[model samples]
Target: MQLPDKKFVPVMITPFNLKAKVDLDAVSRLVDFYLAAGVKGFFANCLSSEMYSISEDERLDLTRHIVRYVKGRAPIVATGSFGLTIEDKADFTQRIYDTGIDAVILITGHYANVDDDDDVLMRNFDRMLKLTGDIPLGLYECPAPYKRILSAPVFEKLVATNRFVYHKDTSIELEQVKAKLAIAKNDPNLEFYDAHTPNAMHSLQMGARGMSSISGNFYPEILVWMCNNASNPDKQEEVKWLQAELSAVDPAIHVAYPMSAKYFLRKRGLPVRTISRAHALELTPQQKQTLDEIYDRFTGWCDKLDITPVNVEELMKPLIHLDPPI
Candidate 1:
């Protein structure tokens, strides 16, 4: 896919309703929430959005809605993957050219992962990037660490291309994360990000440009504020709050994200759903109940922290009514 020129504060979205529909209003609310809370922008249909389950039409509609809402207030780095063949992925890549978006975050899924020789995939990536028009790209490195971690050498080769651009380094290992950061330090043009929230301080210390994560989706101000003040004398106090917020929910993650997220926000009157219908990963009744209960306390924290609640529609307004970054 094409690469992005600017580095962004990207939040992964969650719009799963009961009918498995893409609620544009909820999406807008999320945009509004982040923009007001000081986020640069978002990556809709990303890992947090459960991209594997949504359809092409849905992705397009969502992007259009987001572009309309953002109205150039912030940059939007969308997703473009889900190809059966090289041409198929390329077709998807070219489709984004018309969407008024800045870049596409390319994930390494939907292709057959053959034994060690990933040359075929890389070649396909080259093709996809060429066909993706002139848009910049954001390489999504959220490889479940155990599943598709690319060698640092392979990563080096990819960034060799001037268009390889920015990267989101989500390899769970600290060394691998540090290796990517080290490489980025040498390449002044490359923008590197970390998604390992638990180790945010260590990451910033090691030279990650910033962080993009689901935790940011829940608490964007905290994440960005912490990064913006990583050098402050009160850094330890800031991290203490981040760690406490991070540990609020179960760390098993994957299946629990949407409900927990919506529950917490809804308790704050954000108007999101309390379930998931896309992936259809059914949570046990007891699990759902536990999520609701944790979110109950989450609401209390939000109240104490003075964080205002806003739904997706109200969040990402297409028009910049207030001061437009003069």
Candidate 2:
């Protein structure tokens, strides 16, 4: 399957009602929200989705739900290989890939020992590839549980495979970003989505594909706007302004991830609840006040640029049929 060409693919959050079960209805609404916001594609079951905390059954069900709800509107990719052993992880990957996602994103270096060499990680990856067959693959330098930013040689080895096409380069260093983009250029099929928002403009200016981060969950239209216009010479000033605006969101919200994201979504009028079984971060009064202040700042920035903010109710109206439980 071909990777998504458009920029601003957001790593999606799995919404839950008060009970904290997989809220299928909220999932439908969230999918519609992302699509309406002009996201080029969807990363459904990634770290942002709380993959490490979700049950295997929930993962499968959620992936299938997202695939069906999206209905080919965009390319969907998921991370499902969370099992303890390589064989188990591959088995899970096969199951998630079967749910019609365009690609299965493997968490790079997830199975390696402490300070392990690249050879060990690559061998583990090779075993995963063998078990999953010809499924299109992507790589994520996911920082949770452990963060193994791929070494240049290791990443070069990964790119040599040719099958590992899409990469979520979470590294913040501009030099590292350049190196990965160089590797991406080597293969026509390879694409790198930068997950670090602080350097998104710099990375995009240097040929990185787009932005993928929890911050996108807050101001996706801002991301979409920046991605679409960053390359235009005339828009450099606006891009710089937007980059500064976008960079502030990560620091303000990282204090409480999916929880802050859910609260922001609710503020924007989506019917999602601020409930997270994964992180369970409580929103203190002080944090809530700070978030409100941030939201005001965000809207002011949007107003200045004429960027459209998505209407949650309008987006959800068409998804009424999906209100029933699966």
Candidate 3:
């Protein structure tokens, strides 16, 4: 599927009620929040969504729910590389694909073990491609299990297959991003997205399709602004300033993970509880304080940049779904 230029696809977080069950109501509101903030797509059931903590049934249920809620307003993608073997993974891939998602994302670490060489990974990936029968696919260098970064050569080979349409690159180094972008340019179908928030400006400037970073979970509109203005000649000064601000708070937001994100979103007045199956411990006083400070910074940036943050109140009003201009 073709995505618009400079899109900010949030790595969605799973909202759980007090009993730790998936709150479908809250999830619909979250989708509204993301769309209202100008997100182009959804990465449901991803690492940020605590994918490993939830059951297989929950994965399918949640992805299906998001697809239904989105109502074709935006394209959705979900992780499908769950089983122990390539054959099993391919089976699950098709199962998730049947949920009406645009593409099934394969975790790079799933096809091969942490110690496996690139050759072994390639063989397994080739086997998976053969078994899956022309299903559209994407690559995610997910940090879980292990981060098996794809080499430039391997990336080029995969691009040649003409199957991958999305790539979430976690190679934070700019040089590696540049190398991959060079190869990605040769294939018009593959849209490259960087998962690193700090690299947003540089990556977009270097021709990445957009960003799919965890930072969007906390403040999506800011990320959306970055995507829209990162490559503009007139926004360089503001872009550099905002990039520094995001880089400064990146580590702070990761202190408690999805819990931190949930808390931040609640602070923004969404119905999200600070409950996360991935993070068991409650946010410490200190952790909460840090997030509060980051929230202040977010407001300050919004004010300085003249970006109107999504109105949670207005978004909570009666839902009138309209397809995005994209």
Worst 10 residues of 2 by lDDT: 317-326
Task: Spell out the clash pairs found in candidate 2.
Answer: none
Ranked candidates (lDDT, high to low): 3, 2, 1
Question: Top model by TM-score, which number?
Answer: 3
lDDT of 2 by residue, 1-326 (tens): 33224489999998886678889888888888888888988998888898877889999999999999999999889996678899888888889999999988988757686588778898988888788778889999888767888877788988897778689987788898888788787888877899988888887888877888778888888888877877778788988988887776668788888888888888887777778877766899888887888889889978998977887667766554323321
| Candidate 3 lDDT by residue in tens digits, 161-225 | 99999999999999999999999999998989999999999999999999999999999999999
Q: All models: lDDT?
A: 0.64, 0.82, 0.93
The digit string of per-residue lDDT tens for model 1 on 1-326 reads: 32122222765566655576876777777777777767766676676775666778877777778888899998677777656776776677667636887777777544436354678657767777677666677677554222456568877777776665567777878899888777777777667777767766667667777777766656566566656655455456755665566555536333466655655555444546655654445556776576566555545555755555444445434533331221
After TM-score superposition, the amount by which residue 229's alpha carbon in candidate 2 deviates from its true location, in angstroms, is: 0.9
Stretches > 4 Å off in candidate 1: 1-10, 16-18, 110-114, 142-146, 244-255, 281-326
Q: Which lDDT value does model 1 have at 58?
A: 75
- Order the candidate numbers by TM-score, best to worst: 3, 2, 1
What TM-score fits each model? 0.80, 0.94, 0.96
Q: What is candidate 3's local distance difference test score?
A: 0.93
The clash count for each model shown is 18, 0, 0
